[model samples]
Target: MSNNHGRVINFGAGPSALPEPVLEEAAKGLFNFQNTGIGIAEISHRSKEFTSFIANLESLIRKQLDVPPTHEILFTQGGGSNQFSAVVLNMLARWRLLHPEAPAEEAVMDYVVTGSWSKKAMEEAKRLGGGRVNAVADSRQFSQTGKAFDNIPSHDAYKFSRDPALIYYCENETVDGVEFSHEESSPAAFPFQLLGQSTEKQLLPLVADYSSSFMCRPIPRLADHAIVYAGAQKNIGPAGLTVIIARKDCLVDVDAAARLGAAPVPIMLSWKTLSDSKSLYNTPSVLSIYMTGLVLERIDSLGGLKYFEDLNRRKASKVYAAVKEGQDRGVFQKKVKDGSESWMNVVFEVFGEGAEKRFLDGAEKKGMKGLKGHRSVGGIRVSLYNAITEEQVDTLVTYMNDFVAEETKPKAEQ
Candidate 1:
């Protein structure tokens, strides 16, 4: 295996690769951050230096994603999993404030279950029990097996509630490698137009879990959603920090809602508390925030999201092309449907006996790691996050092409 400072071209889903330069810069910050004479990990989150750093991080996201004034960028410790329950509690609180006399059953949380993550989020919402949970459009119903998450359901299949507390969907599913297309005309795209029509004049209470796809490209209709949250571990930094872009109105006073007969919310889970304290209600994930800031700064220097959007599109195209070639040769089978395929995570099965293991082992031997899929859905998953450069993708594609050729060869010739 070729060694570049002992680092492999990582293709893991979360806690994925960071740019080499960012790592080098973070290494220095680990020792001394902003010339504070203390490491970033040791620096106080409440200190002026740390606060300024965090503010700049928020600014980077806002400027790059073009977040409107109506939305506030928030940083917190819990990952996207925490936000699943928190979104339910907080959005229900907002709904309860609006409908003081309404019963819990009247408040519905609409979930578009395209993949595993969204299904889990819906389960979490059901577990919380503050409101009714409805699967507005479940992809599994349309899958070949009637259970696998292999496609984005047609927009016509959606059955949104009249006035849902929150309409939730995961922008990208890392495990199943299903993503909503950004193109409005694509069948795989999120049905924003339908939601707009259903909601009428009121702002859509749309909550998107962008954990795997965050910061990889421009967010589609950034201003339309009430909340867009992601774990930094996927494309930004470490696992501890979750970046939340919440509409100003969605940050309701949970205590007041509870007083009005809504379910009580914990202080830490309250978005209003985080916004009031400027995300310093408690000690923040200092190191994760610091590294994430560095990553954003680097992204800005590299021509921002536009550059990444183009680069990542090219990278994913190359991988998908290679997969298609393998499929044509009967050497591989893609898991997801054509239009529903993820640009970030590509999942496909290796054909023939012991072929999957051979594919993974060969990739590892060539210094490419994290090619294995999730345990729940065993196959090959190539996570092409922002940090995975075009050249690295080229290397993997070349390996894939070579593996396909070798597998399709006649056994008699061997």
Candidate 2:
């Protein structure tokens, strides 16, 4: 039996396509890592070999992201979803220490809801029994339909608490295809410019979920953030490992917070636990970490993020151009507002009876897969993660243009 299967152009949102070179490199690790007879999956987490590898993985992220010394990089098991609850608990711990006499009601967590993921994070904060979860700015508020979260709200739309425990935002909304502008001064950029004007004037603790867009581009003002985390599945490696870049100050004493009337933080969920133990607190996703390390090495070898950013911009430009052309032809409709369009996930609709299925079928026949939109939102979502090449994007764009031309072509000609 042949052990090889040719890969398709995968546009999945997560557990998404990885670089072919990285995959090939990782395959060797499954059988033997660095000639150690034991495979990476079978290696002991405490072994020096594994320990050194994990350390290098953390260093790669720090070097790539330009993480400052004030922050520490830690690895954990749960994906971004797990952090939804952990973030609240941990941030609340810090708040409790700072405001020992303040009531729980006084604690506030401002969440900027731009898409499904942020909405879910807000819901998790509410469920975690932390400070009040305030929807400071909801993109849906500006939605013409009043329900769709298809864009980032203007800077003035954010209504942050005076002394909030934490300000939370998702840098990229994977499901709804919304993203903040990388430009710092633009209204479309991260709300930092607006936050600077807050009456409090204190630098509020900020946390961001960068699950889908991590390592895709440079993070603006990254050092100022209290915490930033992303799951390795997208643009990196497999699921199970989540990389957290946390400021030392944010890793507060949860026990101290418990004494101050806050709920006890779970040991496993504690950032301090991971940071103190160097991410070797307990059994970790060994294989996932190993694969992610390989991916990072591959990125470094390929001229780092600058190269990827340029490649990604070009790829996204091509697809969005096709989308615009289709819109003009009345063959497609865009889901995101201008400037808020996600570089990682470009969502749109194909107009006509059974057009969506026809689009999927045509793409599948041409070797594209995972173009289907998320279940909650029906339509097409083209995920242009780092692994997706320019050539693959060109193929998709050509198919898109051809599809639109076919759909708009005269019936008499057919």
Candidate 3:
């Protein structure tokens, strides 16, 4: 094992830190995979080894999440946001197919915009659906912090379910440091009829973008008539490949997934074509698939979803403590909600304008990297993904406190 070299606490939000072992395995496989004399980079995606790899990845995802038989797990290119186009295309096509008599105006999608990614998803859906879209919480803001709204059955959403509108939401916001820990408890389920709704209940399909936090825990029960998608770069294999877990009904939508019938649609956007060939539509990225398999295998060996959730909570708690340590010393304060904060991203802001800049500079000099917050919402963000360690977080905490003390000079200096 290579020493961390004090270069620790890599906190980039997506394409974030991956497990060391996964990286090691990938490095080894670069030259040869499974005794094959060729590098994984050279193997054909259609080769048996690659096929087995893809199958295993799909199986692991399904088994870990306990996704229903009705859901189709697909590996294709395009980030989770691409599903914004995929979902609207497939879903609207189905809606039109189901309610042919309904006016074009009535084919509306209800989106709950909680943060940046959700807003983008809403935009994509509207454009794909051709101006027919309805959004809830079309936007949200945190007041003095503490809570990011209870995702569980908001009074408004539950009330709106009566007549029904196509419901959509981002399961978790990667940028804002908010996550829906439980769909059953989340307002997302409100669009679908609850146990209390009468048998004549009319509910919208509960669609969502489960990108950053997808597969971090067990899949939810009330997520019916839903099409969930994720980008692999964050917690999966790599970028440029988005995985969509669709309820069977959503997969057949022609626009939702480009159908080239084996010819390969543009070599990039054809999800249906990719799914049909088990992701071999053209040549898949072998190293990406191989790394995904090794990662999943490691996850399986560590115990499955139940084990991961506990581990993730612990890691997140450690990161939270680090941020709090900075605050307790008057260096920075968290901006996200108390209980709803994301396990993957911890966001905070320094009190003074120059404070953030000074702290980031110190952190980098101390050997930490990628601690900068995203440009859209800048401050300081520490993304503690699955691979981040408690020791690393502790180091960050220690350094943060020291840096804060160093920066707090007397007013005479000002």
Candidate 4:
């Protein structure tokens, strides 16, 4: 720990910080997993060693989140971006089957745009899925909650024609350094979902692009509607892996023609093929799976989802309170509505232009790093992931307040 370089507090986004235990555990077994001669990285994925590794990750995710019996989790390659097309293709395949009479070439899709990624996802759906993607409220900056999307999805459109897969969103935008709080269910003061129409049988699947906050909190239950997918970079393990959680029905309904067609998908991106083999498609990323297993195990030891939920609340509270208190004296600034605050990433603009730069410089001098905001939105973002400790946040706050106090000193005295 003493020899650790870089920022004392790593606030960088994805490919960002990982829990120390996960790293240590992986290191311990790198050369030999469970006393096996071969290192996790060198072993053949088909071997029993790798099979156990995959099983551990699956079991951990199920145990921690208590995944339902109906759902199956598959580990695939290519990030969430790749799934953007795959989801539409798979989902639209299911969609078309449900509504055979509707125009398959020209369908209408809805997107609850919260940030850049969701917005991009919606755009991709239109280009690839070949449909009308209605973007709900869209903004340049990332947001947990803000103004309602201009055109609330019309439940009636789906009521009459093929029910457009009315998609909603929940992504912790790390770019602007803003993320979601609250559990999958409750919202003490305010709840997010407001499905205007009756989402019974006609309702399409809820495709959520949960990239950053995938494992930080409890798995959200999208009212028993759709499916969830995420890339395993930040919280899960490695960068090359992507995990998709979908209902068995979702798979059973995929176009049969494509399932048994003349085309051949090079074995890496094929979810159906991988799922059939229990994620042992081709020499899988044994090292990545082993790494993810360690992470899942570490999270389980911390008392599972509820425990981490409370723990996340405490960690986020430290930064939020500090920022709010400073803002009162006209120092720190809130970029969005205070009511719609985030628990994972805390983002705020400085009161003045130079203040932002000054604060970054001062913080760096004190061993704090990764406080810089994303390139798209220039502000400070403090990303508090599952592994981030309470003390690190406290230290960050202390520096923030002290810097504010120091800058406000009477100019005449100097």
Better of 2 and 3 by lDDT: 2
The residue-by-residue lDDT of candidate 3 on 1-414, one tens digit each, is 126433455778878777887887888888988888878888878778878878888898888888778777777766776677766655655565555566666656667776778778888776655336665553353343423432222435432332333567776777877676564554433334342352222334567777787667765663464577778777766666667777665544354322321111243454455556666776655666678778788888889878778877787887687678778877778876555677777888888768888888888877688888888778888877666666677777788777767656677864
- All candidates in order of TM-score, best leading: 1, 2, 4, 3
Show where candidate 2 strays beyond 4 Å.
1-4, 199-203
Candidate 1 residues 100-185, lDDT tens each? Answer: 99887889999999999999999998898987899999999998789999999998999998888999999999999999999999
Per-residue lDDT of model 2, residues 207-300, tens digit only: 9999999999888899879999999899888999999999999888899889999999999999988888898889999999999999899888
RMSD of 3: 4.6
Task: Compare the candidates by TM-score and give the number of the best one.
Answer: 1
The list of candidate 4 runs beyond 4 A from truth reads: 1-7, 139-162, 166-168, 177-204, 222-225, 252-270, 412-414
TM-scores of the models, in the order given: 0.98, 0.97, 0.85, 0.86
Count of clashing pairs, candidate 2: 0
> What TM-score does prediction 2 earn?
0.97
Clashing pairs in model 1, backbone N/Cα/C closer than 3 A? none
lDDT of 1: 0.93
Candidate 4, residues 154-263, lDDT tens digits: the string is 22222222355546464665554434445333332112344434244544466677778777777655435467888877777878788778777666435452443212
Q: What's model 4's overall lDDT?
A: 0.66
